[model samples]
Each structure stands twice: as structure tokens, then as C-alpha cells.
Target: MPVPKDNRPLRSPNEKGRYRRAWKESHGNLLLAFAGLIFLIGLAMIWASPPGTPEIDVDLGTVDSADQVVSLPPNVILIRVATSQLNSEGPIRIAVYDSPHTFGNPEQAIIKDSLVPIDGFVVWEIKLDFLPEQFAIAAYHDLDDNGELNRALFNAPVEPYGFSNNARSLVGPPTYEQTIMQRPTESTAIEIRVY
Candidate 1:
């Protein structure tokens, strides 16, 4: 029986050789190119990822000579604040408030505020002035140095902020009552960390 003809285009006698040549020219480098692309993407991902946890130390110096020496009352308490997981972008701003009405407005309710510079990475300390019996603390890593906590359009904080008792909120900053820390002693130290 006679077989059908394919009716394809004419080809060279070394048809296999021609195909090999074409494949080598076009696709042989494709695998290598794809591998290079994958390697580049992986490098970028690694570079963009956050580094491991950091370690930090703080230095507490005497009060500035220019500041007046006011005599604190007997009820005045010395509160020491230690923070962890801090970034080195901006100074750490801490404020103590005596009332809930001023917790939301540090400018109005801040009994005493201090801006501590971040000399190291993850840990730092701030020695607060004499505080009253009832007080709450709010702190943040002001990455922008604007002296205010920055938030997104939805009011989500762009800066890393914390409160006494390490208070947190779902939609906004925590309330003063929620962050109040009371100690029976004359001096106390509170620790806060930011991820």
C-alpha cells in the first residue's frame, strides 16, 4: 500500500543537525537566562528582609546645667523606662501624663517629656523626671523627628509607639487608663519593646 505525503516545506539533508543547531541557538541560553533571573529575584528578597533582632545600650548623664533645679515634692517618684527592639532612625520621645484627658493630647497633658537619642540598636533607656502618684506614660520612635507621632491616612501610626504597661489598641492609640502604671515604691522601672 502507498503511504501519504506530508507536503511540508523542503528541508536540508541533515534535518536533525539543522534542528539541533536551531534549538541550541534559541533555547540553549534560555535556561541559563531563566536561572540568572531567579537568582536576582532571590537576592533582592534577601536584601529587603528585616535584619535579625538588634542589641542596644543607653547612657544616662546628669541634667543639663542650663535647666533649673526645682525641688520635687515628697510624692514625686523617679520612673526609669527601658525600651527594646528600637530602630536607629530617630530619637525616642517619652511623655508622662497625669490624667486621661491629656493622654490623647501630649501637648496639653504632658507632665514631663523627654526625647532620648538612639545611640545603639535594639535597647535603650530614659530616666524620667519626678512624676506624681498617678501618671501614665506614652512613648514612640519619632523616625521623622517632627516631635509628633505620625500616622497614615487612616490614622494608623507610621512611627513605632508604645504606652505604659505596653498598652496597645486596635484602631488608635491606647487610653490613659489602659496604660497607667502604679507602684507603691518611690522609684520604679518599666520596660517596653517595639517590634
Candidate 2:
């Protein structure tokens, strides 16, 4: 037989089998150690993170259970949304905008909330401490629960939607100026109707 590439005598069949087993065991051990190291590093990074870092809760479902109770802060703005012709079951989504530039931009909304509708209405309680002096709200009945307002051709909304002050527009969406509401001194309530 030709010499082995390492120039070492070839091992007997039994020795080769034993060596292969030993190599696999050592390789597995190394992998396990590497995995442990990675896990420890992750734990250290998490421990070093700031205490104020917000925790994100992800819900895959369309609506949170109606029984889940959220304690409202002392300062809050309560929004009551009424829906007309709501024929399906899904969460109602609300977006609060703090500036004219962010109005109607879901990605830039200062606050976003979803609530399960009850008897054609949903209530959202938002903390007032961090909000600006003026803000606008845009809400929609998410009939499909796709996390967005479904649109038809020419970007016409296919779902029921409304803006603060019951604002409406003949062309596209209402301007931020038309829908803006001033923040109240104390906890206040506002109503929006989505058609």
C-alpha cells in the first residue's frame, strides 16, 4: 500500500475504529465547550445592559385577550373608538402622532395600541406624561388583523378608519392640522368614530 499522507504507518482496522471514535468524542466536547462560551457571553451582555432598557413583548395573535387587565398610570388620555359597519372580528389599532410630520405615518407614530372591540367600541388608555402638547390620533378597525389598513387600487382604504376630531377628507387623508387635539391638564377622554 502507498504510504499515508502524514508518513505514519497505517493503523490496524480495530485501532482505526477506536481512533475515529475518540476523535468524534473530542470534537463533540470542543463544540459543547464553544457553545457554553457563547451562551455565557450572551448572559454577560444581557447582565451589562442598562436597567431602563424596555422589554419587548411579542404577540402573534391578532388580539389580546379581553380579560387581560392593564393598570393605567395616574396621568393618561383615554380614547373611546366607535365603529360602524364592523362585520368582522379583529383588533382595533390606534396610532398617536406627536407632530405634523409624523401624522399618518404608522412607522413614526409616538404610540401604537391595539384593543379587542366590544359591542362596536374599543377603549385605549395612553400615558400622558411623555406626550407633546398637541397630538393627533388615527385609528382603524383591522378587519383582517394583518397589522395594517388594507387598501384598494389607488390606495383607497378598504377598512373602516377615522382620525381625531372625527376628521374626514374628500380626497385623501385629513391633514394633521384638521385632526390635532390639545393635551389637557388632567386625565381626559376623547371619542373617535370609524366608518
Candidate whose TM-score is highest = 2
Tens-digit per-residue lDDT, 98-164, candidate 2: 9998888899999998887876778777778778899999999998899999988668788889899
Point out the worst 10-residue segment of candidate 2 by lDDT: 53-62
Best by lDDT: 2
For model 1, residues 122-174, the per-residue Cα lDDT tens digits are 22233334445678777777777888878776666666667777777654667
TM-score each candidate: 0.52, 0.60
Report residue 123 deviation for candidate 1 (angstroms): 9.9
lDDT of 1 at 76: 36
RMSD of each: 12.1, 19.9
lDDT of 2: 0.78
**What does candidate 2 score in Cα RMSD to the true structure?**
19.9
lDDT of each: 0.59, 0.78
Model 1 CA deviation exceeding 4 Å by range = 1-89, 119-129
